[model samples]
Target: AQSVTQLDSHVSVSEGTPVLLRCNYSSSYSPSLFWYVQHPNKGLQLLLKYTSAATLVKGINGFEAEFKKSETSFHLTKPSAHMSDAAEYFCVVSARAGGGNKLTFGTGTQLKVEL
Candidate 1:
């Protein structure tokens, strides 16, 4: 079984400041890790994915994560925050190779931005 734990359930930031969200995972097989963002009344948009090949992965909206096998962690980071970046973030895991693209979502980390 594979499981993902998002360290923060909420993050608050001032506009233009950097954003960071922490996540950790446990997987039996080689895992595909993804960070997704959701705006109000919208579906999730893929932020990035970490395949076994790359340690550092970049995604849309200036989000990025590094797959650290030694730490069992995949943490999302952004250099700046915008009001538009205020949304719900999810740490997702899939055992697609073993179980298919069925996704298991984290509880969610709500990002709030101040002007």
Candidate 2:
């Protein structure tokens, strides 16, 4: 199975500033990675994903991530921070190589945006 680690438990940014949520992955094979966001009192929504195709994957709401093989990292970033972007972000990896094609999620990073 693949393991994912979110580097930060919480990240705070001012409005209009850049946002970054770091994630590192470990797997025996090239596994699929995804980023999901959950707003306050809302369900989780897909943000972005990387599946061995292009290293740079663009997702919804102006969010994007670059998969770096050498570094084993897939960090999410946005050029500007919005108040509505405050949410919990999860990093997920596929466990297909291990047996079943299930998605395993790691700890989430809570983002806070201030005025």
Candidate 3:
């Protein structure tokens, strides 16, 4: 039981505004969650990850996510959105077994930053 669902198909924010992308997941056991961003011509980059350490995990580019086990959610948030932040965001769940990692990716949330 490893799956991730992005609650929104698209999220728009004005430049210098706050950004929020909702995400939910289900796992039979403790799961490692991550937020990834893909630009128009770039590969997927890791934004943040949760690995049973800190509840509030911080990552690059003013992005952070809180692993809420009680709620089964890992939502991505940023204090302000930048023009460079306009891209596709995905929430991923990783399960490690047999010396390998199994990853499940969310559909994606298209973030359109308005000027």
Candidate 4:
């Protein structure tokens, strides 16, 4: 079984400041971790992903995350925040299923950026 836990339900930051969102995961096998952002009434967009190739992975919009197998963690971070960054973020975990893969999504972290 695989599961993901988002440490925070909401995170607020001022524009130009840094942003951080924490996540923890559990899996019996090596799991693929991903961060996705969803804006108001918009489709979900992939922010970053860890597919067992690199421990530290970078993604679009100046976002990055490091996979810590020992700690069972994959936390997302950004050097600077933007107003457009305000959205709901999800930490997802995927592992091998019967014949394919199963994806489990975190509850979500809503980001609010203020000027």
lDDT of each: 0.89, 0.93, 0.95, 0.97
TM-score on alpha carbons, each prediction: 0.93, 0.94, 0.97, 0.96
With candidate 3 superimposed using the best TM-score fit, by how many Å does residue 75's alpha carbon deviate from the native? 0.3
In candidate 2, what are the lDDT values of residues 29-103, reduced to their tens digit?
888999999988999899988988999999999999999999999999999999999999999988673565888
Candidate numbers, best lDDT first, in rank order: 4, 3, 2, 1
Q: lDDT: which candidate is best? A: 4
In model 2, what lDDT does residue 14 have?
Answer: 100
The Cα error of candidate 4 at residue 100, in Å, is 2.5
Which residue pairs show collisions in model 1? Answer: none
What is the C-alpha local distance difference test score of candidate 4? 0.97
lDDT, residue 112, model 2: 99
- Candidate 1 stretches with Cα past 4 Å from truth are 97-99
lDDT measured at residue 14 in model 3 versus the true structure, 0 to 100 = 98
> What is the RMSD of candidate 4?
0.8
Candidate 1 to native Cα RMSD, angstroms? 1.4
Q: Who is ahead in lDDT, 1 or 2?
A: 2
